[model samples]
Target: MQTEKITSLQVAQRAGVSQSAVSRVFTPGASASAKTVAKVKKAATELGYRPNMMARAMITGKSRIIGLVVAYLDNQFYPLALERLSNALQAQGYHILVFTSSNAQDRIAEVISDLLDYQVDGIITASVGMTNDLTARCETAGIPVVMFNRGQDDAAVGSVTSANVAGGRKVAEFFVSCGHKRIAHIAGWAGSSTGRDRARGFAEGLAAAGMKPLAVIDGHYDRSIAAQVTRDLMARSDPPDAIFVGNDHMAFAVLDTLRHELGLRVPQDVAVIGYDDVPLAAWPAFSLSTVRQPLNRMVDATLDMLLAQIAQGEIAPRRIEFDGPLITRGTTLTPKGPKQ
Candidate 1:
């Protein structure tokens, strides 16, 4: 048996309304009166008619889709941020198409090409870099791009991120205030702006205190690498009394290594601090002292910048940075006053 598909024309006839009225009811961000909307919806339910977004996009030349590219979701901070971003975009009548890419230039180019092919209204990249060539391509295509939790050297590209440099400096200040002389840092990937800014700020802060890190190793934002770095650091004749890891994801691995493999007591033998106060940091097992990235605020800022670009079409790019707070927990000795 064959069944015919119901159309908006039929729905309008059944509801005793114009075909345009039925369209307004079905199209997101379109206007329609309450009576017309009620009638169209009722008629649509009865006839099992649904709007085809693809066809509408073809006619309107707007897909209402935002392509989101992320480097990796291994970090807890990213998953939470992505959820908030998705919800906020959906509320604004835009849907997200997520694509994951490696740090490689070729892979990122492929991802950008895919986004352009899809005719995405805009693009948001999380924890990924946009090369000048790729940026040129997107600009030529008239697709606005915003970087979330990442910054680019190109002033033309928009970015929203936590005050990573300030956050790193804060951690250093906290460690120094605690009287930790032999301090070391397990830095994030030096290739990233976030990592570079944080490391630079940490070094500057330590220098201001007339002290320097025992060792600064690039963890590359990997758990296993961080764990190995922890071992290598501890094996030194004069090991670090305190270590500040670039992120909570790697910090967890550092904590595990200190406790399980090295049989070291946290804050007793070695105190550890990390950036990005993810949910797991608060757990009793870790109780990690960390700098909290203002995830919600950052997400909101990203949405605002992205939507503005989409609306204004090639407006000046924005660089937004929000300060993060330092949270002290069991992993570090609490200082007198409020948490740093």
Candidate 2:
């Protein structure tokens, strides 16, 4: 037997209210009196009536869905950020539709096209790059795009990221303060702005102190690669006394390699520092010294930029960056008192 769908008209009749009143009750941001809301909800529950979001979207031309595209979630930082983004959007009566994309340009374009087909109100790209053509298509479709935890040269798109450069500099300063002469870096993927910025800042800081890195190698944001890089660095005639890794994900691998494979003592033979103070970094096993990316504030800023565009219709793009504090832990030597 086929069951027919219950319409809002039936609910309105049962609640002794107009169809529009029933609509206003169900629609987000729609105004309805308390009495009307109670009656409509009671009738809806009794009749098993639910508002059709698709029909509402067709009428209002707003799907109330935000498309979130991320390149990878293997990194602990991204999963945490994604959860926060989803929760914040849900609280605003908006739903998130997640999509994964490869770093390849074609793959990213294909993903954006699918998002456009869904008529998503806005798109947030995390750890992914957007091409100019895709950006133009989104602009033509009147869909706003925001970059989360990634940056691009496109001025048309808004972006929110931690002050990666400053974070990297802090790591260098801490290492120099500890009197480590030979310092090296296992950098993040050079293809990413976050990676490049951090490397640049670290170099600048070292240069300011009249010291240069012993070696700077691109880890490509891969654990295996970072492990191999650690081996290669250790094989050098004079190994670095301190190493700064791009992010905590790779840093964890470095720590494992140093301790288990190379029999090195942290902060004794070699000191390690990383970016993104992920939860695992705090564990006694790792106790990694790192720069903390303000995830909550970054998420808040991303939502603010995205919502403003959705409401205002094509406002000026904004680039927001937050500075993170360097957290010292077991992996790095603690300053005796204060720097001279």
Candidate 3:
């Protein structure tokens, strides 16, 4: 007969101790006598035994894990935020179990349920479409959930985001101050709160300055649509002389088409400004002017809010909104700021 593999029970038996004694010895920072720990380690080394986290959580009532759900990693900002969150959470002795999807909203409840099954201590959501049922499930699970860069219509949920509305208004004023008339807007995906807020702000800014865009088209926050909408705007009989793209990714497409396809001059024929001021916006080829969301600061706020809840183990929900800055560059007329 083949020799039976050693188990924790066998380790306890060999060490002449209770099963729970063997368990404490294997659990990090769990109270155990030095002699018992030494005995358990020796038996475990012989048995190639490892402690099971699910079993340990049953004993201790704490599972040191965070479930991170991000829907739009296709957007560079979400990936950047995810990386920062991973690093930040790891420093706090918590690890992320990532769950990603394009339209994660539909399956969000299912995903949260599965994460609960794994006994994660908390959750951070970057999915815009997260449903009310999922939010309710998270509430019932009694685990802290922080919505990152997105918010629910439900005021009860905790979240952190940039001041998109104000930023939109600020950019609109900047465009008018540059004396550009007949402006147009290449909007973000109307589905997201960020997009909606920015669009609303831009409109308010335009109205405040007594300046209205000649045309406003929904870019749907896609690069191809941004370029195509831009082309449509340019091809019109009374095309806009300036364009404010909802985000830098779409703004880049606007620059390419304007310069290469229609051969328009920047800030001369059609002044182009974008939002979110991603790293590539400063690229030598594009050098696009845009609004900045202070992504790192927002990430810090997300980490701070979530970690505070994790440490406190209970608290009222909180929200943080970071201020955005306008970054001037070659594409749009420079404001009274330091040149790039």
Evaluated with lDDT, which candidate comes out highest? 2
Q: Spell out the clash pairs found in candidate 3.
A: none
> What order do you get sorting by TM-score, best first?
2, 1, 3
Residue lDDT tens for model 2, 1-340 = 9878999999999999999999999888889999999999999999999889888889999999999999988899999999999999999989999999988999999999999999899999999988889899999999999999899899999999999888888888888888899999999999999999999999999998999999999998899999999999999999999999999999999999999999999989999999999999999999999999999999999999999999999599899999999998999986556647
Candidate 3 overall lDDT versus native: 0.82
Write one digit per residue (lDDT tens) for candidate 1, span 3-104.
888999999999999999988897888999999999899999999888888888899988999999999999998898889999999999999999999899
How many clashing pairs per prediction, in order?
0, 0, 0
Query: Given candidate 1, what's the lDDT at residue 288?
Result: 97
TM-score of 2: 0.97
lDDT tens digits, residue span 1-340, model 3: 8766667898898888999898778665579988888998988888877767676678777777889888766566777778888888777667789987555455766777788998898888884556777777877877778888777687557889889899888888898888777888888888888788888899999999887778777887789999999889989999888898988889988999999999999878989889877778888999988888788888788878777776796677877788888888998775445448
In Å, residue 27's CA in model 3 sits off its true spot by 7.1
The worst-scoring run of ten residues by lDDT in candidate 1 lies at: 331-340
Cα lDDT listed for each candidate: 0.92, 0.94, 0.82
Looking at candidate 1, what is the lDDT of residue 223? 98
Model 2, which residues run further than 4 Å from truth? 336-340
The reply for model 1, stretches above 4 Å from the true place, is 336-340
Task: Tell me each candidate's TM-score.
Answer: 0.96, 0.97, 0.83
CA displacement after TM-score superposition, residue 98 of candidate 2 (Å) = 0.2
Residue range with the least summed lDDT across 10 consecutive positions in model 3: 101-110
